[model samples]
Target: MSLSMILPMSAFALAASISPGPVNLVCLSSGTRYRLSQGLIFVTGATLGFIALFIAIGLGLYSAMNVMPGLQALLRWAGVAFLVYLSYRLAVDDGRLTEGDTHKAPGFMTGAVMQWLNPKAWLASASGIGAYTSGNDLQQVLIFASLYMPICWLSLASWVYAGAFLRRYVQRPQVLKAINRILAALLLASCVYLVLE
Candidate 1:
C-alpha cells in the first residue's frame, strides 16, 4: 500500500483499538483486580484475535454475511448475550485490594473468545476492512493487519495501565466494587448499541 493508504489504515486501526469496548473494559477490570502481567495476557489474546478477525474480514468473511444473512443475526445476539454475562460478572466482583492476586484474571482464551463474540470487534474489523482495502488484496490486508496488531495491543494495554494506576487510590473493597460496577454498566451499554442496530 502507498503512504497515503497506510496512514489512513493505521489511523483507523488506532481509533478502533483505543476506543472503549468489551475487551478494553475487561482489560481494565483485570488490571484493577489482578496483576498487570495477567491483564497483558488478555491484551495479547485480544490483539491477536483482532488481527485474525480483521484479516478474515478483509479476505472475504464480511462478504459471507451477505450470502448468509442469518449469520449476522446469529452473531449479533450471541455477542449481546456474551456481553451481558461478562457485565454480570464484572458488576458482582467483591474482592478487596489485598485479594487482587486471589481473584483470577481473565485468561488468553477468554480474551480471544470474547473478541470473537464482541460486536464491537466485528464492527470495527468489518468497517476498517471495507474502508481501507480493495477487492481481496491479500497484500494490503496483511499490511493492515501487521499495522493493527501492535496498535491494538498498546491501546488495550493503556487501559490496563490506567486501571493499575487507579489501583493505588482505590484500595478499599467498596471503591473497587464501585469501579467494577461502572465498568460493567458501560459494558452493558455497549451491547445495547449492538441490540439496537
Candidate 2:
C-alpha cells in the first residue's frame, strides 16, 4: 500500500478501535475492578483477537460470509446471546473490593472470545480489509494488522484507564453497583442495536 492509502487505512483502524464496543466496555469494567497491570492481559488478548479476525477476513472470511447468507445471521444471533450474557453478569455484580478476587475481573480468554463473538468487531474487520486491500493479499493484510494491533491495544487501555480513574471516586458499594448496572444496561442496549441494525 502507498503512504496515502495507509493514512486512510490507519484512520479506519483508529475509528474502529476507539469506538464503544463490547471489548472496550469489558476492558472498562475490568480496569474498574482490577489493577492496570492485571488488566493488561485482557487488553493483550483483545488485541490478539482483533488481529486474528482482521487476518481471517483479509484471507477470505468476508467472502465466505457473503457466500453463505445464513452464516451471517448465525453469527449475529450468537453475538447477541453472548452480549446478553455479559450484560447479565455485569448487572448482578455486588461491587465488593476483596483481596485476591480473581472472579471479579474477567480473564484473558474472556476478552479474546468476546472479540470473536462481537458483531461490531466482525463488521469493522470486514470493512477495513475490504476497503483497504484486495482481501487476499497477505502482505498488505499483515501490514494492516501490525499497524492496527498497537492502535487497538492503546485505545482499549484508554478505556481501562478511564474506568480505573472512576474507581477512585466510587468509594461506596452502592455507587459502584450503580455504575456496573449502567454499564450492563449499555451492553444490553448494544445487543438490541446489533440485532436491529
Candidate 3:
C-alpha cells in the first residue's frame, strides 16, 4: 500500500476503533469492574477479533457477505441476542468485590466473541477494507490488519483506563451499582439501535 492509502486507512482505523460502540462499552464495564490488569486481556481479545475480521473482509469475505443476505440477517439477530445477554449480566451485577470476582471478569474468548457478534465491528472492517484495498490481495489485507490491530488495542485500552480511573471515585456499592445499571442500559440501548439500524 502507498503512503496515501496508509494515511486514510490509519485515520479510518483510529476513528472506528475510538468510536463509542459495544466493544468499547464492554471494555469500559470490564475496566470498571476489574481494573486494567484483567481488563487488558479483554482488550487484547477484542483487538485480535477485529484484526481477524479485517483480514476476512480484505480477503473477499465482504463481497461474499454481500451475496448472502440471509447471513447478514442471522448475524444481526445474533448480535442483538448477545448484547441483550450482556446487558442482563451487567444489570444484575451487585458490584461487590468478592474473592472470586477476578474470575468473574470476562476473559479473552468473551471479548473475541463479542466483536464477532457486533454488527458495527463487521461494518467497520468491511468498509475499511473495501475502501482501502483493491480486490483480495493477501499482502494488502495483512497490511490493513497490521495497521488496524494496534489502533484498536490502544482505543480499547484507553476506555478501560478511563473506567479504571472512575473506579477510584465510584467505590461505594450504591454508586457502583448505579454506574453498572447505566452501563447496562446503554448496552441495551445499543442493542435496540443495532436492531433498528
Candidate 4:
C-alpha cells in the first residue's frame, strides 16, 4: 500500500481502538483491578483478535454476511448476549483492589473472546476494510492488518494506563464500586446502542 493508503488506515485503526468500546472498557476495568502487565496481556489479545477479525472481513467475511443475511443478526445478538454477561460481571464486582494476580482478572482468552463478541470490533473491521481495501486483495488486507496491530495495541494500552492512574485515587471500595458500576452501565448502553443501530 502507498503512503496515501497507510495514513488513513493508521488513523482509522487508532481512532477505532482508542475510542470507548467494550474491549477498551474491559481493559480499563482490568487495569483498575489487576497489574499493568495483566492489562497489557488483555490489550495484546484484543489487538490480535481485532487484527484477525479485520483480516477475515477483508478476505471475504463481509461478502459472506451479505450473502447470508442472518449471519449479521447472529453476530449482533451474540455480541449483545456477551456484553450482557460481561456487564453483569462488572456490575457485581466487589470493588476491591486486586493488588496481585489472585483475583482472576481477565486474561488472554477473555480478551480475545471479548473482541470477537464486540459489535464495535465487527463494525470497525468491516468499515475500515471497506474503506481502505480494494477487491479483497491479499496485499492490501495484510498491509491494513499490519498497520492496525500496533496502533490498536498502543491505543488500548493508553486506556489501560488511564485506568491504572485512576486506581491510585479510587483507593476506597465505594469509589471503585461506583466506577465499576458506571463502566458496567456503559457496557450495557453500548449493547443497546448496537442493537438499535
Model 3, span 1-197: residue lDDT tens: 68988889889999999999988988888878894778899999999988887788787787888899999899889999999988998899898644346877888988898888998898898888778877888898898889999999999999999988888777877777888899999999998898788
| Model 3 segments more than 4 A misplaced | 98-100
* lDDT tens per residue, model 1, 115-181: 8888778889888877888789999889989999999999999999999999977788889999999
Span of ten consecutive residues with least summed lDDT in model 1: 95-104
**What lDDT does model 1 reach?**
0.87
Each model's C-alpha lDDT? 0.87, 0.86, 0.87, 0.87
Q: What TM-score does each of the candidates earn? A: 0.94, 0.94, 0.95, 0.95
TM-score of 1: 0.94
Candidate 4 lDDT (Cα, whole model)? 0.87
lDDT of 2 at 29: 84
- CA lDDT, candidate 3, residue 126: 83
- After superposing candidate 2, which stretches have Cα over 4 Å from the reference? none
**Candidate 1: residue 128 lDDT (0-100):** 82
Tens-place lDDT digits, model 2, residues 1-197: 68998889888999999999888998888777777776788998888988998899889888889999998889889889999998998899888755477765777777788888988888899888878887499999999998899899999999999888888778677887888899999999999898889
